[model samples]
Target: MSHFPMDIIESLRSISRQTGLPIWLVGGTVRDWLLGRPAKDIDLIVPERAFEVGQHIADQLNGTYIPLFETVETARIVLRESKMIIDISNFRQKMLEADLFARDLTINAMALPLNGPFEPAQLIDPTNGHADLSRRQIRAVSKAALQADPVRILRAIRFTAMLGFHLEPQTQQWIAAEANRLIYPAMERITEEFFIILQHDKAHQYVDVMDKLGLVRVLLPECDRLRNIEQNNYHHTDVWAHTRLALAELEAILLSIDDLFPTHGEAVRHVLKQPMASTRCISDMLKFTMLLHDVGKATTQSKDADGIIHFYQHEKVGAHQSRAITKRFRLSNTETKFVQNVIRSHLRPLGLLAERDHLSRRAYHRYFRDTEKDGVVILLHALADISATRGKSNWQTRRQNLIDLIRQMLDYYYQPQPNPPLLNGTDLINAGVPPGAEIGRLLRQLAEEYAAGTITSREEALAFVKQAISPDATTTPHSDI
Candidate 1:
């Protein structure tokens, strides 16, 4: 417990001294301490008056005391000073041992009393959790664990992904048996837990695990439909197999992203590491988006007179279709829009194959302007698709050509071009334009001109806007402060 602030522990010990009600630091707090990991939050169990002691400790630490559950009288103390959280609660059962036994996992069932010095010898491991920790396995405290709360099914896999631990034999059986109950939890909680697993280094392996455990059937039933759908000769496997291959290939590509795009290694890493909506990293979202990229194929699949299969405008169809799933998962609006945009534009890189050796400036302009530099991320996803498709004998040649095109695309995207418009609403309003959508349209037009090399100076921009707004008149640039 030396990892924790001494003052906070002291306050709890003082409370015990005065009230004479036994307080124990239980569950994850004790487990994390044993694992030598720092604690961000601790669970405390007291005989009674959880709110009173929680408020006192909050005041002692200058934190806020928020009452949680009125029946159990659970209260939370958020300490900004140490960036830690302390949750005080009355025992769920009559005693600490019963409360510990009632927990989800054995590793999280350990505890230590706050009345004395912190020592491993003081640990209350009623379930032999210490041995399981040594084994790096997650074992449920009882067979009724999953039945008590179906959400723990997701939590069990989450621990495996987070800690790189395996499930004990019986625990695995319980998970496989109770996997469908995962659909019963609140969608937001389920989404949050799924995002955590996607953040793992090799999430595809766990995706395979989820598939085998039958969780995928309940969580992503659409995938079952994709399994029966076959693909054209450009792909050797059916759509379902290719989808799994895509996820695995994408993970490999991301891990070696620096080597693949050596010159822009750090730039690509920075974009992927950025947090998207709900505070999930862009890298995590990429996996989800990639898996669903071809989902429209389920409905759009067709065959021509030659029996060659085709998925016409699947990108557009997929973007339109994925809305329901995105909404179901409770993704933030910003995240939803991003996923749809990627799905719509995923085929842009391949479409460039028919163009000349060097792409036009306007071609780059439209893609980057629409995506707003997020095209860098789209390029990575496109490369993964190309890598996963190995049906053609000349696949390497096609892949190389696409790689060259991407390098050129990224280079053009990163060039030191001047910031667009050279104008703003203030400048426009100072001139003759009103403060509304018209100003935005004119600015967008000016930005387009700047990108296309049609206008080079503020003087030219003023003339172009004046000519476009009123052909008979000329306007001057804004100068006075």
Candidate 2:
């Protein structure tokens, strides 16, 4: 609601009357208005010269113009006061009726004339979109509509999740008949619609729907290979099924954050909302990473003498295998690195938390020190991974222990050391110490000692450093150092 500019409609109509160019509010704007939902963005269509018209309207309203002049002759305006976006474009097929028929969905084909008074009678419904809206269904404008743009198939899926609408049986059959058309569009276009689906609240459920609709096979063929791959005794389902359940559990964990992590829930939630790439936030990445965490287990499966299964270093192998997937998706360097790190360290939390009774201050320090900002994400994935393992193990006890481990780790992560860092590389070099890895080693050691409450002041830290680098002292720390 904050993004809608309430006073701009008159200005737009005034400009339209003066210029004699009929601008109609089309697509989602009109649909949301008719549905009694607050509009976040606006879409308009003109007879022609959309780029120029869009810029002229922006200038008249003191808004900023974002040129989207492409094959469709589109441009955008960001209202300075409300910060809402308006996308204006030329009619797709040169006439309003043709344009409406060319659209993908009936619900989106309606347009209201901006030049006339606002009224329901002024609405243009070519494909009986109003009837479809009343029925809460998504029906294609025509079969050729999808044949014109296969990417709209993804939009149909997104609409079902976002608007809580169902695709009619005929539309579903059309989608099934040509599901492979999804692969023809540019990857960027496919990703645009794909991410909208992924960002929904029920993404876990709809993603499986996408798989069943035969779209996932065209996008991620590797997923089909995960089917029926068996796992160790700790898992009740096969690899693909467990992966889906893990994704579901991750969403459940996020929803139940207050119960699972009462004190640090909000802070952890805030971190998960950060943007990892242009289209994906940290939460999206977390869900996606869970889907690929055990990809290496298929190649690493082995049976010991006791007939027990083992997947030695599958995390490492999975990490190595994840690059190709990231590259195929054209993920940015930051997102690619994040996915790799999560797969590489997905098994760390349990191993580190297994010794909670004798857990060293150095262990806590080293784990967070090594992971830094990624620790939160890694720990959340660990919980989901273990939560999905509903097999022959002591499930309830392990679940409690994992949750407690997450609480302790998050506490250590949020609670800073009582004292500031005592020594820097410059100070170490000034003290005749070498300027290299040893300085880093000494600083890490000091951080651990500070965590342990053994080193407090600058004087004590300097003496420890002096003793650490001395010829006779046999000083060692955690392996991570």
Candidate 3:
């Protein structure tokens, strides 16, 4: 067996001797240790009264006790000093053999004796889990195991991607046969598993495998609808295919972001690593956005008189659709807004690039302002989207142009503001402007003009406002304007 900290070993021995209960190190912890991976969490199985044992362990180690599930006599002890979690649970059945047999996968069914010497000879493998581990394959213990809990279907995919393992043929067939059983689990559980899958570096590969097994259709019907929705010649594949490729490209960009743009690498990494909501990182959220970026194309697909396909306002429609999806998954309000805003503005970078020469300072300010702190994220998504397509002429030049645009946005974001506001709402109210919505509109206009470099001083802003409110003014003072 692999060496563990002396303190952990001694603690386990003390707990086993004090309680006089049979405790065994079980499941993923043992599996990970045998594979030479650091085990952050330890799982211990007892014949009965697992909660009492968990409480004893918590008191012994002065760790925080978390009651995970009362029904199954399961609890968790978080050892802050070691940064390790000890999960205690009762056997699923009366016997240890039955409990091990009931596990989801063979590689996770092995256990080690915790009360005695921690050695490989002490392992209790009711199934050939060690051999399966040696072969780097995920084999289901039995079909009944998965039938008991369909969430293992997703877990299988996660392990395949994370550990670089392949599913056994029987296991794959069982997954396909029982894929629909996923609906029986709580949406939160499903969402958590899906989020974990997205956290992997090569999530797209496993996601494609999930799609082939019909899991995507059962989980996200919105994305399934994009499978055959054809796009214009600008795209080499259909909507769903392009979306998948974009997701893969997103991973590639993140992996090589530092090498691709050394100047803004730190800023890019910081933005992607920030937490959004429910402990989900911004990078995982971006992967979800990329998958659903073109979902609106399915509904808004139309052919003009000359047979030219058009998805006009798809981004706007996609934003609304993405909001509904996020709500269904019970994401926090902050997360919902982040996903919706990014989807809505996914096309803005390219739109700005089309008018690169005429992109005023005010336009730059508005782009970053509307995208919020996700301006860099939106630009990366746009880059992945463009890289996935084939029909764009001067593709190399366009890619370079996008890189240049990202640098400009990053400079604007990280560096000091070029034009500070010369007037605020208070300033406007004090300048004979009424305290109402009009003040806000006029202040925003002044700020825009200031960003455009047309007005530099408070007196110039006052003069510009004066010209706008005058009867001889040709332009109207609208909120958006």
- Top lDDT model: 3
Tens-digit lDDT track for model 2 on 136-241? 9999887788988999888888888889988789988888787999878888788778778878876888888788888877887766677888887889998889
lDDT of each candidate versus the true structure: 0.82, 0.84, 0.85
Question: Which ranking of candidates, highest lDDT first?
Answer: 3, 2, 1
Any idea what lDDT model 1 has? 0.82
In candidate 3, what are the lDDT values of residues 393-476, reduced to their tens digit? 777688778878777767766765445567777777666777899987887777667666778888998888777777787874
Clashing pairs in 2: none
Work out the TM-score per prediction.
0.86, 0.91, 0.92
Against the true structure, candidate 1 reaches a TM-score of 0.86
In candidate 2, clashing pairs total: 0
TM-score of 2: 0.91
State which candidate, 1 or 3, has the greater TM-score: 3
In model 1, which residue pairs have backbone atoms overlapping below 3 Å? none
**For all candidates, what are the clash counts?**
0, 0, 0
